[model samples]
Target: MLVIQIYADNPLRNFNYLIACPSSREALVVDPLDVTRCLAAAKQHGLKITKILNTHEHWDHIDGNEEMRRHTGARLYAHNGAMGVIDHVDVGLYAGDTIAVGQSIKLKVLDTPGHTRSHVCLLANSAVPGLFCGDTLFNAGAGNCHNGGNVDDLYDTFSQQLAKLPDNTKIYPGHDYILTNLKFTLDREPGNRAAEDMLNMLLDHDPHNAYITTMAEERRINSFFRLDSPVIIDKLKSEDPDFSAAPSPRDVFTALRARRNTW
Candidate 1:
């Protein structure tokens, strides 16, 4: 059995995931920001953490790496691009690299550079498949491209790479920004029933309770993934007259990202 545990960390509402194979009792922690909480959770489950996987070099994601490693003595894995940024990476991962944990849990690495040039996401091919998306992708929005990030790169990461994932793939983002992101989507496409319904459902629960979402649900509500939709396109055009010049999907995405940075 595959055990996936999620913990919401402090200071930034960050999420850290512990994925373990019960048969072998070997586990990997994804984007651990709070070492104390993570170690405690692992001890509670009686799982030995064998590896620390980073999705990016952001402080919130890798802050607890050294401490976690000190406690568990787990090897660190990060993208090759994060060499200088991340202090210690035992294994420099790339786009096609696969990480095998225990006997059956295998995670495929995807180079999803947008939040940062070296950002990568881990796709777990387990009984319950999931995508550990860092800041590159979110529940209803994509990451900002202000810090060493490119809009075009983010566009491709979402449209070409992440969009190809199975509809049932569960998304585990770095932060719990779902409620705010969905609110922004509603503002952009008020006529969208999917966004409205999702917003209402989220309102019923605490913001912290609605962090995880499926790709299928994201497709229905995430405006970033629906750049080509007529409603979204029209909304963009209305917001910015420059967008009316026969903008491509990429252009629409670019405009939306810029607007979201301030929104």
Candidate 2:
């Protein structure tokens, strides 16, 4: 069986994941922002940290790589494009590369840029599939295109890459911005009951608790992924008069992202 543990860093709201193969007791740490906390979690699970995988080179994501590597002697992996940005990367990976945790578990890397040009997501291809999407994808929103990130790239990442994942794949984002992102979705798509229902359900849970949402759930609630929805298209057209030229999904997506930036 595949074991996944989520550790949240207080104050920052960053989520770090520890994934392991129970039979082999071998594990990989994903975006460990807090080395001490991650080490403690690994110790609690009695799993050996064989590898450290980074989703992006952002300071918050790769900050603990050096410390974690020093303590665990694990090799660090990051996208090849993040070389200078992530100084401690021992092995630079590409889009189609796969990393083995043990004899049974494997993590497939997807080059999901736009949050940052070098960003990647790790998907666990097992009975219980999970995606460790960094800032590239949030629960109801997508990452901003600031700091060398492009909105068009983010659109493709969502509509092309991430959209291809199985609907049942559990989404484990880098941050817990569900409530806030849902509020933004509600603002844009007020008539969407899926977003409203999800917002209410999430409101009842402890805000600090780690959330694991499925792609099916995201497809319904996430405004960024619903570019073809009539409500979203109407809203975009209403907001921008020039958007009457039979807006493509990309056009609607770009407008949503632009509005989100100021929201």
Candidate 3:
């Protein structure tokens, strides 16, 4: 699988992906907000985009869908639930559905609802696995439940589905929030040497190339992955006098999300 990740120069720092089969040059666009850039990328790579997929029904994610579809004549796709929210979906994807990109590449759709009820993540089952998680997951933080999302559902998505994926799976999140999220991790777990080191490294790293974190790397830097750490629990306790000392992982996750909303 060949991946061309384009960084949309908007206030949201959205990362649009153009994934193609190197052999066939048949491609698919993910959450394409910048239509011109996507078209230019396809032109540069000599790829034929056969499909356009939105991970959720957020306006920003689907803003350029109509134009892109008109430009490339690509079929539009989204979760079945997004039928009401997103327009002109040629295919409504389900949990186990595979989106075939050319002859060899197939992406398994995972029903990952938390960022929104319509959210779904696509797992490319290539030699080097890649998870194109829109707002469901981030570099060092998890999506908040303030906008049509549930904290419990987000936690379940992490523990039951995302956590089970191979540690080597490359995480391709929709936006660039690694820097702020890493600061949040340090704010919660000041003793995390791994997070600290990554923070220093990322100061020089381009945010455009920041979405290539593996599950193994996330385990060390992402606080959501380290919900059981004493330092994070202690920080929670210190901030909220009534915070539980022996908080469950889910409890820790809930508290962290709540705090991040205000932080």
Predicted structure with the largest TM-score when compared to the true one: 3
lDDT to native, each model: 0.85, 0.85, 0.91
Estimate, for each residue in 176-248, the C-alpha lDDT of model 1 and write its tens digit. 7888898889877778798888778777655345447889988988988887788778878887776666788
Per-residue C-alpha lDDT of model 2 across residues 118-214, encoded as one tens digit per residue: 9999888877688889899887779988887988899899888899889889988888888889999999888889889888888865634656789
- 100 Cα displacement, candidate 1 (Å): 0.9
TM-score for predicted model 1 compared with the true structure: 0.95
Number of backbone clashes in candidate 1: 0
Candidates' RMSD to native = 1.5, 1.4, 1.0
By lDDT, the better pick of 2 and 3 is 3
User: Which one is best on lDDT?
Assistant: 3
In model 2, the number of clashes is 0
Badly placed stretches (over 4 Å) of model 3 are none
* Candidate 1: regions farther than 4 A off: 1-5, 204-211
TM-score of each: 0.95, 0.95, 0.98
Q: List the candidate 2 regions with Cα displacement exceeding 4 Å.
A: 1-5
